[model samples]
Target: AEFEIPGYLVWGALIYAIFGTALTQWIGSPLVNLDFQQQRFEADFRFNLVRVRENSEQIALLQGESAERQRLSERFGRVVGNWYMIMRRTKRLTAFTSSYAQAAVIFPYILVAPAYFANKIQLGGMMQTASAFSSVQTALSFFVSTYRTLAEWRAVVARLDGFETAIKSAAAEAISTSSIGVLSSAGRDNIHLQKLLVNLPNGTPLVSADSFTILGNQRTLVIGPSGAGKSTLFRAIAGIWPFGSGSIAIPAKATLMMLPQRPYFPVGSLYAAIVYPAEVGAFSSDRVREILIAVGLPQLASRLDEEAHWNRMLSLGEQQRLGLARAFLHQPQYLFLDEATASLDEASEAALYKLLEKRLPRTTIVSIGHRSTLEAFHQRKVVLRREGDRFVLQNQAEGVKSSSDAPLA
Candidate 1:
């Protein structure tokens, strides 16, 4: 406007800008989707590589080098394939923008020459008109030039949005009012379940515990046939499972810990890993060593200062022993062993049970095992019998009632 350029030049520039922008967006539109796929593919391939690295020993033992190479190649193939698509799309966009820029150099001359030839404007006026038109064209093509960057940024934003949405959705589902309710009951000596029905994520009822109470300071064993939702039952009491309805009223201020078949140990010093979920210095090194020795891990007694991935370095049986050591150190009010000792020999399992009985007699020990040897350790037995599609918790101490009658499922 300041240049006093011809109105026709402005009109021509506007038309050129509008068409350029449309074409740029049209050519680059797929880049957003392509970039998103590229990120996902890259992540998947990296994750597969990590998985292979973590399981390198197993792969080597199985002599699966050829199989793994093929698997990794397939994963990398997707990454390369999507990158090519992005490259092609970007090339097309670049070509169009390059031509558009070259055309813009002379576009002002074409518009102003008419006025100059008609002897209506001076040569300086023609030069000034072209300059002004070029400036406007640059401003308008700014979006076109930065379209690739914008697409990648948009793809990142989309992935972040999706990640946040998934996390929020999981949180929402976990706390949904329709799911099972876990509450702490004041002045209650026992853990109680009233009208509790544990269901799978798919809304299938797995176990029904209507009126169950686990008396304080007692050992209990839970046994059921395969696929009887044995582990799922304990998950409900831990307040981690949310697929069911009704309420589980745990004793007030009772500390509970569930030791799964595979216990997770952070990659750190043996002392830190053993007392995990507890700070490094929470338990004195001497105390952790004693606990480790008591758990029949005397071989690891002097290795408290050793830092490594205990989960990977130790065998499953060794890991289970470490898990027991953790329980002994933590001394939780209730300890649920979900086949935690299954890896150990029967004698070793018996010895651990004896140790628990002697050391933490007040702590309620709940074991889920198939061995008849477990019954000798527990005063009570809770069995899950398949009725229809789901299993119902039956207490041998009581009668054949649903989950509510039994203390632990």
Candidate 2:
């Protein structure tokens, strides 16, 4: 009878151990998925705040602080609510697991007590039975304990998969029918656009042209109303805005640079910020110093090694000057400016244009600006005129006159 009781206890333990382990593993998968999702939500919440801070100036100028506050609050509220739900689910799982563990500890004693009372088992036998039963239960209940973790893990996978899908979709849109193709130069001295059709994000036609060219080493100014697609043209040339149909033939090995109204400055030393898109050793310290002085920023030359948030440190005028300094250093084959010098005074703007002409005599200069004073610096002017729902490029006779002899518009 004693041997029979020991055998029965061992058999029961083995049966429970196998079944318990399987159950635990099955349930634990979902909990792991849920934990992963929670982490993704936390990261997304932080990313939103960074975006808001970056656009704080625009929000402030538009008096959208309250609205933005509400929007951010709502976003954070969703994060908090979701976290709370996750925590509650975890709490329930923990509660059940703890109860099951406790019961497993006592269950073996209760089951083998009958043998003990009948003088069928010794103290050692009873202890061994209890240990085996607990091990079996532990193996079986793994899922119940880890269900929350599995769920979190699944959520994380889903979020990451969704983000990747979005990126792919964007890339596809950038390459398909909506994309603009920049072709290799065919020994063309001029930038040419053939059968170009520019469209808005919503697929609304903005500008359609059969053919156009900007001659090499010539200054061409593009003038249009606020929403007339000047900036979009620049984007198309840069190959970033793909919502256009056409081939832009650029010189195969030509260096092209675009200076936007608000230039970007990476967080670092002043010198690093000035020579960005180029390595640190691309220009010597003395060369950078000379350009800074030429742009009326000699004081900044001494602070070359000093690190700071340059965008926040310099005024708009100063930043524009720094942009010119960048152009002076890089000396690209073609330079496109989208209202790049709009922030400076007319005199300063004129001075910068003259300095550019003097320093970069061989560089093709294309500028988009509303300022009439800019006409005197350019050899040609192209105006975008509204035609039905789209704009067409019109070459004004004024464009044929040389800047040196042309009357100021």
Best model per TM-score = 1
Tens digit of per-residue lDDT, candidate 2, span 51-136? 88878888999999999889889778777877776676666556656665676788789889998899777888888778877776
Question: On residues 65-156, what C-alpha lDDT tens digit does candidate 1 reach at each position?
Answer: 99999999998999999999999999999999899899999988888787889988888888888889999888877887788899999999
Give the lDDT of residue 361 in candidate 1.
Answer: 82
In Å, residue 339's CA in model 1 sits off its true spot by: 0.5
TM-scores for every candidate against the unseen true structure:
0.93, 0.82
* RMSD after Cα superposition, model 1: 4.3
Provide the lDDT at 268 for model 2: 95
Off by over 4 Å in 2: 1-76, 106-133, 405-409
Q: On a 0 to 100 scale, what is the lDDT of residue 373 in model 2?
A: 85
Clash list (residue pairs), candidate 1? 209-403, 209-404, 210-404, 211-404, 211-405, 212-404
Tell me the lDDT of model 2 at 2. 48
Computed on alpha carbons, the lDDT of every model, listed in order, comes to: 0.88, 0.82
